[model samples]
Target: MLLEPKSLDNIIVGLLVDNFFKWYVAPKDLWFLDRKKQADAYIKKFKEIGLKNIGNKIEEVDERKGIEVLDENSFIEFIRRINKYAVSTNELRESLKLNLLTTSKQDTFYSFLPSLYVNVDKRELYSLYPEPASYEDFVPKNWSGVYEDFLPKIDWEEKYWYDKNGIDLLNLENNRGKK
Candidate 1:
């Protein structure tokens, strides 16, 4: 999350990046393979935080070095500080401003890897140890409330692929029995 920062009055600062990952990437089930092994793998992945600069260039950050994890009390304070930034200051009805963050309360958007926004979605997460991907989850998270195998984004089936004889490949798949 944060490499190092000074104390904020009595509260410690810096807990965005790691906590965000915990909320998402940290698998809810701990009883697969082995507990210690799975935890180690998860923590190691969290250490490699993704960063994208203003230029949209992405990079990997090892958050483990010289970093401090947030305690329960400090974490609550951190969330409060974050929420203060999320309050929408720009009234969309009055102005034509389209920047979503113009009215957001997040003080800063940590450009987690593969992301350009302060809030990183699951699609932006890169796995160091990737599990075998099932065809079912290819449609990306933004497609709906859940990951689905069938993506409306895919339009190839609608287009025709012709063979040497000009027979459509798609029709051939269905016309297998009819000579």
Candidate 2:
């Protein structure tokens, strides 16, 4: 289903927030040097490597272009780029400091998604993908808990089930009850 412009904006913001948090709390071992210095080095390395090599492997799977698969190293590089180019360093530092002060490591505040499906028979909720989504899919790997506060409540009695494509199985008549 098409998302309203505002909904799309929220999704983007949520993604940014989640990514920033992940970047902030990443294991120190991931960067051999200090955080800021490591970020600077990665940015330089990314520039030397060039943009042609940076992208989601899934998007380039067919062509098999010389795309460097986004592993931990690439993730760090991209995070550094965002930190250096997208947001001001002071702003990012303050935001991260505030986040660390107010939010717990286990908090699910940064998690966000467009939808999830409920399986009444199993009494379970899951994403549309058969496999769990990854960072490459723009879905935060560490996010947890349901986003019920903003999303519509599921009508469990309706016994609705959605396919991988997000089509509601029980309500195919007018497709009015889609998740």
Please provide, for model 1 over 25-136, each residue's C-alpha lDDT reduced to its tens digit, 9 standing for 90 to 100. 1111210212233334445555566522323111212221221222333334434434422211112111212222353322111111111111123222222112232112
Can you tell me which runs of candidate 1 are displaced by over 4 Å?
1-67, 71-73, 88-179
Please count the clashing residue pairs in each candidate, in the order shown.
Answer: 9, 0
TM-scores for every predicted model: 0.17, 0.20
The lDDT of each candidate is: 0.24, 0.30
**Can you list the residue pairs that collide in candidate 1?**
50-113, 85-105, 85-106, 86-104, 86-105, 86-106, 87-105, 88-103, 109-118
Worst 10 residues of 1 by lDDT: 109-118
lDDT of candidate 2 over 27-135, digit per residue (tens):
1122121233333444665778774444322222221123233223344454544342232223333443454466653231232122333222222233322123311
Whose TM-score is greatest here?
2
What is the alpha-carbon lDDT of model 1 when measured against the actual structure? Answer: 0.24
Q: How well does model 2 score by local distance difference test? A: 0.30
Per-residue error for 126 in candidate 1, Å, reads 9.0
CA lDDT, candidate 1, residue 160:
21
How many residue-pair clashes does candidate 2 contain?
A: 0
Residue 63 shift from truth in candidate 1, angstroms: 17
